[model samples]
Target: MQAVDQPERRATPTIRYFVRDLDAAVDFYRQLLGFEEELRPNPVFAMLYRGDLRLLLSVPGTYAGGHALPDGTLPSPGGWNRILLQVVDLDAAVEALRRAGVHFLDDRPSGVAVRQVLLEDPSGNPIELFEPATGYHERAR
Candidate 1:
């Protein structure tokens, strides 16, 4: 969709989570979910990476992230929407996370084309783990 004269561009996928404790959030992502810490520039924020995914962790009501909106609404964590990570073995991953005392919304894997379990980070933001099933489908590269 671009002109040949223009350079190609790549955008990193990013998700910002408003957490209660930035340090704990950083630890949870880095230690539990296999994310590597990319930046911890301030007390209120951190950046983590897993593959092409860039995660931004920020404390609520402190940094540039969680300030109140013009309607007096403050951003908070714990929503239904979540980031889904595909895994080879969902049960093994869930078992390991269970051993580490991770909070899971549901550990019973269930899906049509992909089995999945939902778990929460330290701040209660949902993260889904899925394993492809017999009819699993993905776009061609």
Candidate 2:
């Protein structure tokens, strides 16, 4: 059998968040969420990465991804749907963020699976920080 050449591949998950202010969004992700800026092609678009997660920040009026529907409804930020980030110490993380003037929606324990705290980005996009409980594996089963 002859060997075949294969193209390189990578699996880095990405999510796009529509924001009103591109610079503010970049600062929030870079300083608070620990995402390093990957690229800023222009004023309208920027990319940030943390581990395997790539975040795309787009300004509604300038970026194509933030374009309105044919019905004339414009894209906007803020919704219950959110990005979940797993943390080792949920409480400590929450406290630190709170001290830095970040606002949290709530801080609660989700039974035995995980302890979660919800916060919003500058544009009001939700982000959940959770720490799995010690018995999380058992509860998951």
In candidate 2, how many Å is residue 37 off? 0.7
- The C-alpha TM-scores of every prediction are 0.88, 0.86
**Total backbone collisions, model 2:** 0
Error of 1 at 61 (Å): 0.4
What shift in Å separates residue 36 of candidate 2 from its native position after superposition?
1.0
lDDT of 1 by residue, 1-141 (tens): 745563367778889988988888888888888899988888988889999999888887875488888898889999998888888889899999999999899999998888999999999999999998854476322
**Candidate 1 whole-model C-alpha lDDT, 0 to 1:** 0.87
lDDT against true structure, model 2: 0.85
lDDT by residue (10-114, candidate 2, tens digit) is 657889899989999999989888899999989989999988999899988664488878898878899898889988888888888989888788866465577
- State each model's CA lDDT, in order: 0.87, 0.85
How close to the true structure is residue 84 of candidate 2, measured as C-alpha lDDT? 90
Q: Between which residue pairs do clashes occur in model 1?
A: none
Candidate 1, residue 106: Cα displacement in angstroms equals 0.8
Stretches of candidate 2 above 4 Å error? 1-10, 138-141
